[model samples]
Target: MVAFALAAVFFLALCLSAREDRRRFRNAVLFGLTFISLSVALLLQLDKVPNWVAYPIVLAVFAVPTLGTLALGVFLIGNGVTMVRKEGRRPANLLSMLAGLGIFGMIALLMVVQMAGSRVLDGIVGTLAVIVAYISFLFLCFLGYAFLYGRIRVRGDVDHVVMLGSGLIGGDRVPPLLASRLRKGQDIYEAQLARGGRPPVLLPSGGKGSDEKVAEARAMADWLIAQGVPAEHITLEDRSTTTEENMLFSREIMTADDPGYRCVVVTNNFHAFRAAMMARKAGVNGQVLGSPTAKYYWPSATIREFVAVFWEHRAVNLGICGLLIALGTAATLTT
Candidate 1:
């Protein structure tokens, strides 16, 4: 009952945090955390037979991949039809269509693996479960870190600042995602200026996309200048097409005179951790700052970011999961 109660409490916490609107990943993980915590609690209360039974039940739960596969199928069919009708099957759209179909193929492969191997591979059934459990744990680690890291704020002196650009709507104007970043960056920039710091160079780093009328960096630079930030203080690095490019290009411009610079990367609050990871990869030694994000977009966006990070270092991630699974399988086998 105590474990159940704690699980319920965490589940509630997850729901509350999900209300941040745009952060779908955080909310989904919160709900997941609640469910797993409850499962862990229930495991503590069960005897051996029940514990054994729980494993199969969890195995059955893996069948949700079918539902995901179905969803993918339907979406791809609809998207393909629309794309074919509207664009006459463009190469890029066709690639997206193929990717969607490829997901269903993966689901099909897993289903076949389960069905054909169910008899003799029953031993490895537990093995698979252990592997999956650890993968879930890997997800949990990222979700936990992302949640906690989102709460941290950069509230002090800084010499250099980078407002990492999110894409804008209609190719020119600041969308809410990018706007939130700029506002946060501006606030930090103003705060520093007020505290007798002359003015930190605000690097708005993004190149213009083919679809966009102007570069995002220039838009951000203009916004800052109008907010009473002096023209000389805002250096626009207007040629980065991606986040890595944004960081690398901005750093190159900022560190043109001095390579060793202390700085903060400003982005949406939900993006702070991934941005920190990116900055670390780019060899930038600075903390990250997140501004307010809309509630709805964050969950899906943050989850996508988390998956990207995990896959970015898949060997390490897979190795850690492998270790955990090995341990769990041995423990289960022994018991």
Candidate 2:
């Protein structure tokens, strides 16, 4: 019953997370499965559940960590291959490939260990493996939830809106990506004023492309001013090519009045978490808000964010994978 209850609760959390934040959906699926598996394993320990009933139920629960890790492993390997080929041997690219391969190797090793053992130690190892798997899954689930909560909470209190830019379409117009960021920023700016908050500053941050006519920052700043934002309320950060620089350089203007500040970052929905991560890295103290995105672009974008997160904490991700394989292998050999 406790097992079922836990599973039910985790499931509910996932459903809510997925519905509200698509970036969380993949993590949510794996998380819910892990929770359900643990719940069943707990149930199997009951005297009321017979070996015949309990063993299979336990087996099903135990399968999630191994299988989930295996799937993630394969994905990493595939992405690694793609990364190496497309990006050459740049250090960053190599790191990505290595991380992906690390997942693949761990999962593959676990499967091999499972295949080789059927003893008492094997059962023990299997149980341990499942625990580790559940832990990793939960961590990812928590990460998604934390980012979501932070995004929502911070946006709700935002008094200043910053739109980080990408390239413009045809070197002249707002692409969907940039437009999403701009619109969300504008909306929040208006909302704050409507609620009697003093007029929020709207900062459009981006530089020009090598072949472009105008800086994205200037273009976006103009767009907002045309929409009735007083020219005085707009700040143009016309010299940042990367997201990090966008926040850093913008922070200069943002803090020109006072070095200490709280502001809201605006980006596409799929990008909110990563953008927030960048904000933290750039030493900008603030939360992130997201604008809507077209459906077709989300999968690739979300995957990119996951990869970025993995890189952001390489030792932790790989260490967890290593521990899972070791525990699973040891328990299998022992039980």
Candidate 3:
């Protein structure tokens, strides 16, 4: 009953946090707590069931996480190889592969420690394990909440659909990734019109890269025009470089056009939640929508997103990690 009550409290906190601002990282943590508490409550009640059912449940509880971790490690390694082949050898592309290898390395380290029986090594492993567990928990929370956030639709009419820009291919052409965002933005504009609402202005937000012949917004604007969107409906925000700039500069443009304006920002699905968080911080009067991304690219991209979020709140995250490590070290010494 205490576990059940804790789950309910976490669920209520999650609801309130999401209601206040769906983009909050706190919502993700609360969501994770709710899920964990509920799982614990259910597991605690397993004793009431028949031995036959309880046995399987107990076996699954122990077996699934181990099996799942191994499976995930393999999958990430495979996807990483595919990413390198299909994409490029950029460091970003290597994240999934490195993560997969890291998992196996940790597993090996655990085995080695167990065999060697060194107290110092045991303490170190224990500290690392707790840190890894904390990070993994946070990653799962971010992933689950991001999926939920992507599904949420913008309510009422929006005055602008801001498509955040990515790097152009060949220094002048829209890459498939940026094109996806543009298409999603166009669809939103068309949907509003189809629903008998006024068509929202399309804002392609990106500045020129050093190697690019033109600003990204110009390339995106050309793409939108070629797709049959009216030239008049397209606004070029050709000054912002980063994602934060994308939100802030676009907000400036939208606010200049209409102080009372509402808008929807668009980015790739993996980037959507982080962009939404940035948009909120930038005081953009809007929510963000995610366009589809390639399947093989998602894990690495999502990991990158999580890393960025983790760094954005590094003070708190690092403090907790340090605290955990200290406690683990103390406990090991005592033991």
Candidate 4:
């Protein structure tokens, strides 16, 4: 009953938080709370079953996830090889592969320690296990919420469609990644026109890089013009290099024309939630939409984005990690 009640409460809170601000971190927390509560409710029902049946069911649940994790590790490693072969041998491209290797390495180290039967090794592993558990829980939450946030439909109307910039391929040519964002922006612009109102302005946001021949905004604007969007409907915000600057400068342009401008920022699917978070922090009155990305590129890019978010909240994360380490040390001393 308690579990069911908590589930109900969390579900209500999830709905409320989502309604209030889908971009807020509280929505993720509420979603996780609701899921955990419901899971507990389901598990509690197993108390009514015979121990023989319930015990096997419980064991299978744990075993299945362990097997799944191992399988995922293997898949990441293979995908990393494919990324290196097709994409390049850059450090950024190696993250997924490295992560997979790290997972397996940790597992192997634990097994070795167990085999050695050393008290010191056992104590270290125990401490690590607790810390790993907490980090894993947070990772799951981030993955789940990022997926959910991207799936959310940005309906009604928007006054502007802001496309964030990725770097050029050959000094000025639009890369597939940046082209994907432009395509999504064009779709949004057309959708708004079809709804029988003034079409939203398409704002391509990016500054010139040291290596680039022209600004990213200019390249994006040319792409939109070639795609049949009128020159008047497109605006170029060509003086911002970073995503934070993209939002800030775009907001400046929008506010100069209309102070209460509602807009949707566009980026790759993997970056939508993080961009929306940045937009909110930058005081932009808009949400973010995502375009499709290549499957092979998503894991590392997503991991990179997650790392940025973790770093953005590093103070809180470090505080929690400190507490966890303290708890582990206390456990070791007591034992």
Best by TM-score: 3
TM-score of each: 0.62, 0.61, 0.97, 0.94
Candidates' C-alpha lDDT: 0.71, 0.70, 0.94, 0.88
**Model 3 alpha-carbon drift over 4 Å, by segment:** 52-56
Candidate 4 lDDT over 151-180, as tens digits, reads 877788888999999999887999999999
Worst 10 residues of 2 by lDDT: 20-29
Candidate 1 residue lDDT tens string, 183-292: 88888888887888767888888899888889989888877777777888888889999888988887787688467777888988767777777776777757778888
| Segments of candidate 1 deviating more than 4 angstroms | 1-125, 319-335
lDDT of residue 57 for candidate 2: 67
Residue-level lDDT tens digits of model 3 in 287-319: 999999999999999999999999999999999
Give one digit per residue, the lDDT tens place, for model 2 in 2-78.
64666666667767755544333344454647565666657656678778887766666567655876676666556
Residue 15 lDDT in model 3? 95
lDDT of model 4 at residue 98?
Answer: 90
Model 2 / residue 165 / CA error / Å: 0.6
Q: After superposing candidate 2, which stretches have Cα over 4 Å from the reference?
A: 1-147, 155-159, 319-335
